[model samples]
Target chain A: MTAPHEPIPGTTIFDGRMAMKGYPLNKMCYSFNEAAARQEFLADEDAYCAKFGLTDEQKTAIKERNALALLAAGGNIYYLAKFIGMLGLNVQDIGAQQTGMTVEEFKAKLKAAGN
Target chain B: MAKIVGGVTTSHIPAIGNAIANELFEDPYWKPFFDGYPKAREWLAEVKPDVAIVVYNDHGLNFFLDKMPTFSIGAAPEYQNKDEGWGLKPLPPYPGDPELSWHIIESLVNDEFDICSCQEMAVDHGFTVPMALLWPDQTQRPVRTIPVAVNTVQHPLPTPARCLKLGEAIGRAVASYPKDLKVVVLGTGGLSHQLDGERAGFINKDFDLMCLEKIVDEPEALAKYSIHDLVRLAGAQGAELILWLIMRGALGRKVSKVHSNYHIPISNTGAGLLVLESAA
Candidate 1:
């Protein structure tokens, strides 16, 4: 069922529609829950995404390692967290990339906003 | 017959767990957030429930996207905390109440809520952080826990209405138990703040305060909120606040607000803490 509301700007809600659209990408990230799966993906990214049946858009997003792109391609942040973890990145790092700021800048913004 | 003692709702932010583990509460930056829990600790000391039903969402820890359950009940005797790849030191295993968990599972299913029964599950920060906040002394866990894991990670998360209904069913189930047990429902997660996308630092204090106020007495009104509305109004990660409804549901209709604390930007979250005692 579609949400009986207008879409919020600059935010891609990971609703059922996005979940279905990005299933392959999310499933691939889900595989990272296992250490061996993470290692396998690191060894051959294309082969791994192919196994999970990622779409061309998802494959590109994975190759790019862009959190926003993955979200656009149907990657839930929690699942995508595993994918980012594989790259030695944390949620703050992804947040920085999404907001087009450096990690230090993003953290500073967080501190300032809280104050 | 058993009675519902109360419900506790808090944002199970992972950073809060780290601060507590590292003893960084004394630090000025973290002091305010940590300060919010002493009253809760005192309250728990006063009315120690025999069983606490912890309602939280797993964040890619135990059940990944492979077979995500909409509602999973942990019936195991013990739940171990695991490292979620960020190297946060895992906490000591928490004891579980199998009997109560089974009762909840059977009752929820019979109540038409298809819940996945989990005999084995390792809890992430979503489960452990709140535990630490409630009972800081690891040696003395005040209550046996039955973890209720909900699907807020993947899409098609149970609507607010369904979550409220699930809680009500749990309340009925708890009341049906033959033992003279006291139960507390703990709902953890969200009060607005997104962790990703261009709106990463988003925090709506007004929206969150509104939620905190309404959740105490008018939770039924919250069921009208669609997930889309939740994400748009409260941040994406903040949408997990729906889990709070489950705890509120288990408390029955009338509840007394015992104590509450809300702070902004606890690492990209409007962290909230609330305690509601069953009016009965």
Candidate 2:
């Protein structure tokens, strides 16, 4: 493992260390860039995770389909977007999940925060 | 010899593309955001260049985590837009300038930039949305494009200084070409707005405005901003502003800001646009 660095509060910075740690998870997510990979994963997620060699924690995060959990498990948001996109979720939906709010609530917050 | 004519910068938000596709420009919710582009489109029409160097980051449409290149230049004859799993209608294939792309690759490599040269790339909204905004009509694209893809998604991102230096190298490369070509460099993505975490809705108009001001004259100063500090000040996704420095760097030491516009909360972003011409 690499030396531990200070963590930014309210943000999971996907630094080199996280990139290394989440390689399998990110690689799996990256594969979803192709439609066949997205379908294969949806058809059998466990097998897909195994094929990419995801860790137990990463596997659990995938099963839960939680963006924050996936981030905690070392998934970068860009790569994770592919995973969420497979579920018909957008970045806003992931933001809603990360902030522990419903999608509607998050959209309301965004609308209210207009400049 | 070729000359770097100028640069354009804008936020390549996907929602902006959706608005344009659905004809929501006149809607009150999107009007302010769309209001900022007419001048840009008009300016593009007036200053038509032979080629445009588009600087943007891919959102997993091409080059995934498997082998993420810190900097990738598309040298293909043309680039096709990918669906990105969102069912958005793909734009027509963009014509690429391989000759210019090759010249840039050779120049950047000689300058020790160590860029990844891609013969084929499927562009996502990062490359497409801004083009859509600027050109609006696919049949009449203002200029052919050469895409410069930087890695802003993975952390340990290229520093502002590095991006600036790369841009300078690119400027040199473009200028060194023997052909008498007019080229415009475009830096896309970010003007503040985070996309995740509890701080998901983060937006700093002051910082975004500061960038618009500083990028015109003092882009080198922006290099001092650390990635962590950028995330704090500009938000996660907003950190992509570093890409703008690439465009600024290519414009030489002095530039004239010909046009600019800024509006807030375009789907959780402080959308900004600018056209800078080389002072020389």
Candidate 3:
């Protein structure tokens, strides 16, 4: 068996432990792949999340539109991206939100990395 | 017998799809990323490979956690792209080569890499973006495809070394095929960029450039990085670089770099493009 993964300070691994914990949240986000499901979630947010049996933490994180909170609540970025997309927000906006940067600052950090 | 004409690597960022749909190729914000592709397209036009094996990861579009396959290959007659939320319009279905797909499936399993064989798969941007970048005009798409899906979405993702072996296995599969064919392997996704947690928007240029250089000559050097090492150094989603190794492995021991491009901050990611021709 492989050794336990050493934690990365600001990153979540989304391994089996996290996957099992976040299944309900991710399962709900996965439904957004369909137009009807996205529309349904938009129409009744709380009911939609409730139907998926999202944990209170997941539900709260969703309400806050917080990416880091979602991660703490067991959300995988790829799946959570679908949920973020439904909010008419792309990765940049959520990225800025997570790192506490303005969208421009977040984008600038990315640009400077290339320089 | 088949010949691997070359390999192409590019980021399959969904934002690129939006930029394409909006005809923002010349838009300053997107110009650098878009500029990288024309040379790649020129290279493709010249090679005219009959088949393209796309090595990419699914992003909640095909398999959810319910039944995630560590590795999956499309054996369907055609693969389709579906609504991935955020309303990126799905592209037309990509036709496939079932015969070739089966040949690869058998060879990989024989090589002891038991992968999931999908009769049906819904490819997301991971598959479609690279196709669009390479063959912008779908009607004129000169190449058929075999999507080799690796699991980068969840943890316990395959190691860089293992994925390289898988690619070598695929190379053997293509070489053994009886038909005369030309194949191009495409490794899609990542130079480096993290997309989740307090670390979102992370980009590592040094690591990105190192992989680009090493991928050409020292792929085993790349294989040396453990999955955790990659996540730590490359960022979470940046770990998708392993997919590129699969493309590199198929290129064999010697290759000549045809053209390469790298740009950063494309929707919170470092986008890279590389075209290599087998020299061995």
Candidate 4:
């Protein structure tokens, strides 16, 4: 019996020949991977805030508001990273942006901002 | 010998196809656009292509951002519909031409172009919406199809010119195939539409009109457009228009516009269609 879901061997999906000639696959792939990693970080708001020096209040706000939820509702986390990139911050910097004080003041500032 | 009977371009505004299939004529948004395709509908019946090389983009369904390819070709027996976040559209799967597909594959390979050959894959609305639009008659679609997937959804997508070069490669591939059949190169997606950010509703009629002009008269000129230029001028989602160049390129430099239509009832987007046949 033939096994199911087998792709024809030795086929080229994207032509690597002209890949970087006009469009650089390397830069594209790097940005995509970074975006995916940021998505994973956002999925768990609490840990993400802590790792990025967010205060308790900010962490609670992130968890409660579910900032990641905003990213999820929109298609593909890649675009969200683009938005963050536009703000001149990576996913980690997002937590810092919310909290003016160090990691200690994150939670309080988050709660204060929520008000 | 395969001659591009002509090429068709359209915005494929989701609602337009939905309105037609479900017979929702009363829909204010779609009525005008649907009415515009009467000539296009007639044209499809007249040409009756033997095999259609559908050039479109996949929205993270078959291949994700993980390892996205700039271009991917489908050589499967049949393709099912994919549910992309929102549920799948109500339609039967598409039939493909494996014989012609293999022939095109071999020819394109011999010409030194690498093509991805998929045995089992489901095509999204990018392929099906146009299918439903061009071939509304269930009894006779007149041609089988080969799905060509381009990586347009991702950030580092191929440039407009790169897409066009691939089209030339496609043209050469189709010409060399040892089949005496009529082929229709259907390049789907956009005159313009942007589905993101505060600037979500953006439309650029001048750029879109220029695209229609180039697809028929001077496709090479379009290759000079960068992804940033397309996105900035046409809106981010509007960048998908690059895929249309592939269809134009496949038809080669000698083509005449048999039919053309454009509408912008929807905000921040423009839709247009063109039919081109190889010059006699």
Second chain TM-score, each model: 0.98, 0.98, 0.98, 0.92
- Candidate 1, overall lDDT? 0.85
Candidate 4 residue A28 C-alpha distance from true site, Å: 21
Give the number of the best model, judged by DockQ. Answer: 3
What CA RMSD would you report for each candidate?
A: 2.4, 2.0, 1.2, 12.6
Local accuracy by lDDT, each model: 0.85, 0.86, 0.90, 0.63
Candidate 3 local lDDT, B1-280, one digit each (tens): 8989899999999888889989998899999889988999998888889999999999989998888888899999989988897776656788899999999999989889979999999899999999999999966657788998999888888989999999888889999999999999999999898888888888889999988899998899999999999989999888899999999999888999999998887987888899999974
Consecutive 10-residue window with the lowest summed lDDT within model 2 chain B: B82-91
Q: Candidate 3 chain B: minimum summed lDDT over ten consecutive residues — where?
A: B85-94
What's the number of clashes in each of the models? 0, 0, 0, 14
Candidate 2: misplaced stretches above 4 Å?
A: A1-6, A111-115
Model 2, B1-280: lDDT tens digits are 8888898898898788878878998999889888888888777777778898999999988887668799999999999997676556667789999998999999999899989999999998899988888888887665789999999877678989999999999999998999988888999999888886778877888898899999999997788998878988898888899889999999999899888988877887888899899976
True contacts kept of each: 0.52, 0.56, 0.92, 0.00
lDDT of 2: 0.86
- Please provide TM-scores, in order, for all candidate models, with all chains considered together: 0.91, 0.94, 0.98, 0.71
**lDDT tens digits by residue: candidate 4, B1-280:** 7666677776655445556668865677556666767788787778777888888887555765446766778888877775443334446667888887777777777766666777776677688788878887765556788998888755567778778878888887777767787788888888665443333334577788888887688877877887767767676677778878888888777887777877664323577888787765
Stronger candidate by DockQ (1 vs 4): 1
